[model samples]
Target: MLTNRNILLCVGGGIASYKAAALASKLVQAGANVQVAMTKNAQQFVGKTTFAALTRKPVYDDVFIEHDASKIAHIDLADEADLIVVAPATANLIAKLANGIADDFITTTILAATCPVVVAPAMNVNMLEHPATVRNMERLMADGVQLIAPGVGNLACGWIGKGRLPEPEELVETLSGLFQAKKLENRHVLISAGPTIERIDPVRYLTNDSSGKMGIALAEAARDAGALVTLVHGPIRGTLPSGITTIDVESGDEMLEMMLTHYDQQDLVIMAAAVADYRPTVTYDRKQKKIDGPLRIELEETTDILRTLGERKTTQVLVGFAAETENLEHHAQQKLIRKQADFIVANDVSRADIGFSSDENQVTVYGKDETVTPYAQQSKTTLAQNLIKQFAEALR
Candidate 1:
C-alpha cells in the first residue's frame, strides 16, 4: 500500500529516535519514497547523514536551507507529502505541535502540511502520564491527528510503563493500513448511530445513554477509507462529518425507514445505533400534567431493524451491535445467529469506564461459524479504524 507514496518521517528528540531510523529503512523497503526530517535534538541521537543514507534522500534539518533557491524548503516538503509520520514523538514535540509552535524544521513543515499526520509517542512513563502531556495528546487527537499509541514496557529512562515505541514491523503494518484505507473506494457504506427516542409525551421521551460517538467514529473511519458513507442517526450529541450524508431521526421507526430506503444500494450496513425496543402505544400530543395516582400506558414493541436488514440483505454485508451488561459473548453469538448478521460487535455497557458515553471501548466481534475476535480497550476512533479495515477486507 505504501508503494511509491511520499512519506515525510519526522524524528523527535528522544531515545526512541533510533527506532525512527529503522522505521525509515523499513518504509523505504516497502517501496515508499521517504524523506527524513529531524529535530535539532534528534540529530544528536542519530545524525542527519544516517537518515540520508537510509532513505537515500537529502535529510531536511534546517528550515532556512532551501535546496531550491525559488521554492521554500518546508513548504515544498509539506506540499509534496502524501502522509507525515512523527515517530518517537517526544513530550516536547507533542506540546509544540499541540500548541502550534513552528520554530523547528520538523514542526514548521508539519504546520504547513495538509496531509494526514500520524504521531507515535515515546517518552518516560511519568512524562507520558503528566497532566500537561495528557492534555497535549488529547488536543492533538481533537485536531484530527492519528496516534499510534505507545507500547507498555521497560523504558530507556529506567521507568516501566506505557511509553515505549512500537516495534518497527508493527509500525510499518499500521502505516500500511493508513494507505490501504482507500480499500473501500467506490463502495457505499450505511451506518446508524445514536439513541432512538421513544416518546411518551410531547415533553418527555425514553432514550438510552448513547452519545453516538462510536457511530460517528465509524462513519468518519469509513469515509477516510474512501467509502461513500451515509450516516443515519437518532438524536446525537455531536456534529456529523461534513462530507458524509447525514439523516436525522427522532424514533426507531424513522431510523428503520431511512435504513430500508438505502439498504439495497449499500455495500455494507453497520447497525450501531441504540434503537429503542419499545415505545408508548399512544404518544401524548400535549405535555401531561402531574397525575394524581399511578397511571399506566400500554407499550408496544418497535421493529427490529437489524434483523429486518439482515433478512433483506442480498449482496450487502450486514453487521449488528449488541450492547449487553451480561453474557456478552453468548448474547453476541445469539444475535449473530438470530439476526442472521455476518458479524456482531458486542460490548458491555455496564462498564462505567469504557462503553456508553465514554470515548474508549472494548469489544468482542462474533462471526458466523463460531469465530470470535476479541479486541483490547482503546479509543473509539482507533477501534473504528480497525473494524473498518477488517470490514474492507471482508468486502474485498
Candidate 2:
C-alpha cells in the first residue's frame, strides 16, 4: 500500500525514539518515499545522519535551513507528504500538537500538512495516565487525528504500564490500512453502538456488558472508507478516531431520537446498540426500600428502533445486529425478515473469547435473500473493514 507513497515521519524526544528509526527503515524497505523529520530533543538521542542514511533524504529540523533555494523546507515537505506520523509522542509534544503549537520543525510541518496524521504515544506510565495527557489525546481525536495506542509493558522510567510504541511491522500495516481507496467517499452513515441503560431509580439502573468495541470498529472503518459518520452511543471507556460526529445517550429513547434526527441524511444506518427490551413502568425519584422480599414492578416494552427505521427508510441501506446465544441462524433470519433490514449481522455472544467486551468478534451475516455467510473470529478492526467491503459490494 505504501508503494512510491511519500510519508513524513516525525520523531519526538523520548526513549522510544529508536522505534521511530526502525519504522522509517521499514517504510523505506516497503517502497515508500520516506522523509524523516525530528524535534530538537530527538536529535540528541539519534543523530540526523542516522535518519538521512536510512531514508536517503536530508533530515529536516531547522525551519530556516537554506537547503531549498526556491521553496520553504517545511511547506515543501508538507505538500509532498501523503501521510504524517509521530512516533514516541511524549505528553509535552502531544500537548503542543493538540493545541496547534508550531515551535519546532516537526510541529511546523505537521501544522502545514493537510494529509492524515497518526500519533503514536510513548511516555512514562504516570505521564500517559495523567489527566492532562488524556485530555490532549481526546482533543486530538476530536479533531480527526488517528492514534496508534501505546502497548503495555515495562517502561524505561522504571514504571510498569502502557507506554511502548508498537512494533515497526505493526505500524506499517496500520498505515497501509489508512491509505486504502476511499470507497465510501461522499456517503453519510449513521451508527448506534454500546448498551443503553434503563433506569429504575435515580441511583439504580440496568445495563449490560457491552463495551461498544464492534460499533466503534464500524465507525472507524466507515470513517476510513471516506464516509461522513455520526456515532450515537451509550457511555464508553475508550475514544474513537477524531473525525466521527459522536453523541452520548443513556437510554434507548435517546438513542432512537438521535438516530432518527440524522436518518434522512444517511446513505447507510447500522443499529449496533444493545438497547433494553423493557424499561420500568414507573421510575422512582429515589432509591426503593429493601423491606420487601421481592420487588414487583411492571415492565414496559421499549421502541423497536430497527423495525421503525426499516418502515420509514427510503433509500438507506439498513443493517441490524442480532446477538444471540442459541439458534443464531434462525434468529438472524427472523430478524432479517421481521426488521426488514438489508443485512443482519448475527453473532454468538455466548462465546467468552469473542463478542461483548472482547476485542474480537465472530459472526454470520444473514441477508435479505436468506444467504448465510459466516465470518471467522478476528480482531474487530479487521472484521469491520471486511464487513464494509462486503457491504459496499452488496450496495452495488
Candidate 3:
C-alpha cells in the first residue's frame, strides 16, 4: 500500500531517533519515497548522513538552508508529503507541535503540512506523565493528529514505564496499516450516532449522556476506508463530520427511519448510537406546568433497531453496540444472539474515565462464533478505525 507514496519522516531528539532511521529504511524498502527531517538535537543521536544513505534522499535539518532558491524547502516538503510521521517525538517537540511553535525545521514543516500527522512519543516516564505533556498530547489528538502510543518497557533514561518507542518493524507495520488500500472501497456503510431523545413533554425528554464521539469517529473511519458512508445521528455534542451523508434525528423512531431508509443500500451497518430503550407511553404535546405533586411518566419500549436490521440483513455485515455497567462480555454475547448481529461491541459505561462523553473508550468485541477480543483503552478514533477495518474485511 505504501508503493509510490511520499512519506515525510520527522525525527525528534530522543534515544529512539535510531529507530527512526530504521523506520525510514523499511518505508523505502516498501517503495515509499522517504524524506527525512531532523531536529537539531536529533542529529546528535543519528547523523543526517545516516538517514541520507538509507533513504537516498537529502536529509533536511535546517529551516534556513534551502537547496533550491526558488521554493521554500519546508513548504515544498510539506506540500509533497502524502503522510507526515514524527517518530521518537521528544517532549519538547511534542509541546512545540501542540502549541504551533515552529522554530525548528521539523516543527515548521509539520506545521505547514496539511496531510495526516502521526506522532510516536518517546521520553522519560515522568515527562510522559506530566500534566503539561498530557494536556499537550490531548490537544494534538483533538486537533486530528494520529498518535502512535508509546510502549511500556525499560527506557533509555533507565526508568521502566510507558515511554519506549516501538521497534522499527512494529512501527513500519503500524504506519503501513495507516495507508492500507481501502478495504471498503466503493462499499456503502450506515452508522448511527449520539443520544436518542425520548420526549415526555414538549419541554421534557429522557436521554443518556452519550456525546456521539464514538459514532462520529466510526463514520470518519469508515469514510477514510473509502466507503460511501451515511451517518444517521442524534443531538451530537460536537460538529458533525463532513464528506458523508448526515441525517439528524431526535428520537429513536426517527433514527430507526433513517437507518432503515439506507439499510438496503448499505454493505455494513453499525449501531453505535446510545438509543433510548424506552419512551413515554403518554407524551404531552404542550409543556406541562409544574404539578403540585411529583408527576409520573409511564414508559414503553422503543423499537429494537439493531434486531430489526439484523433480521433483515442479507448481504450486510451487522454490528451492534452494548453499553453495559456489569457483566459486560456476558451481556454482549447475549445481545449478539438476541439481536442476531455478527458482532457486539460492549463497553463498560460505569468507568468514569473512558466511556460515554469521553474522548477514549475500551471495548470488548463479541463475535457470533464466541470469539472475544478485548481492546484496551484508547482514543475512540483509533478504535473506530480498527473496528471499521475488521467489519469491512468481514463484509468481503
- A best-first ranking of the candidates according to their lDDT comes to 1, 3, 2
- lDDT tens digits by residue: candidate 1, 285-311: 899999898988788999999999988
Q: lDDT tens digits, residues 1-396, model 3?
A: 789999999999898999998899899999999999999899899999999999988999999999899999999999999999999999999999999999989999989999989898999989998989988887887787877767666988898767888778767766776798889999999999999999988889999999898898898889888999999999985456667889999999999999999999889999999999999998989998887988778889999999999889898889999999999877898899999999999999998667686666899898987888888776576678878878887887
TM-scores, all models, native as reference:
0.73, 0.78, 0.74
lDDT of 3 at 119: 94
Return the lDDT, model 3, position 63.
Answer: 96
lDDT of 2 by residue, 78-98 (tens): 999999999979898899999
Residue pairs clashing, model 1: none
Please report the candidate that would top TM-score against the real structure.
Answer: 2
RMSD of each predicted structure: 5.1, 4.2, 5.3
The per-model lDDT (C-alpha) reads: 0.89, 0.87, 0.88
Candidate 3 residue pairs in clash (backbone atoms < 3 Å) = none
| Candidates, ranked, TM-score | 2, 3, 1
